[model samples]
Target: MSFFPAVGVGVIGVLIGGVCLMSQRKSLFGALLSMEVFTLSVYIMIFSVVWFSGSLTSACLLFLSFGVCEAALGLSVLVSLVRSTGSDYVGSLVSGHF
Candidate 1:
């Protein structure tokens, strides 16, 4: 496996995930799914870097922390939104228009 290929994959994944996130911001599930994709891409990039460098303990730890934080915060917001609104429909959260 070459570093260039890994970098390319990571970049492409990030771009695709970002587009999904931006395009579906109106939907809570879509936003969560997009964030998951983005996080997976970041994990892939970190793993590739570790593979090439032969040391990734620190990177892996950071990745774990990042994942935990992302999941926690995302779920918290989702839960709060549902509790306040009594529904998980992302469209309802929007004020003006969809």
Candidate 2:
């Protein structure tokens, strides 16, 4: 496959990740979605490098596992936050009235 194209894709992925990072999410769900987008972008960049090198397939699998687990943990924490606080908005959390 074309290496440079993959590299370009990786760069685009990073830009997406940056955008996700800079955004101010409205709720825990929004935050989790943003985090996932960031994770996927990083994973895309890593996967591209691994795939192009034609080795370290095992590492790629591990990376995929890490991404899944990270998302799960984030969701669980979000659920807990919503259940205990009764609100999902970031503004609610910031006001210290939850």
Question: RMSD of each candidate?
Answer: 3.4, 2.2
TM-score to true structure, per model: 0.79, 0.80
Clashing pairs in 1: none
Please report how far candidate 2 places residue 42 from its true position, in Å: 1.7
Lowest-sum lDDT 10-residue window in model 1: 89-98
State how far residue 53 of model 1 sits from its true place (Å): 1.7
What candidate 1 gets wrong by more than 4 Å, as runs, is: 94-98
Summarize candidate 2's per-residue lDDT along 1-98 as a digit string, tens digits: 78778777767867776777678567778767777777777777787888778786787778779989999998888787788778777666745544
Top model number, TM-score: 2
Top-lDDT structure, candidate number: 1
Model 1 per-residue lDDT tens digits across residues 1-98: 68879877888899999999999846687788888888888887888888898875787778868887998899988888888777767868766432
The whole-model lDDT of each prediction reads 0.82, 0.76
lDDT of 2 at 13: 69
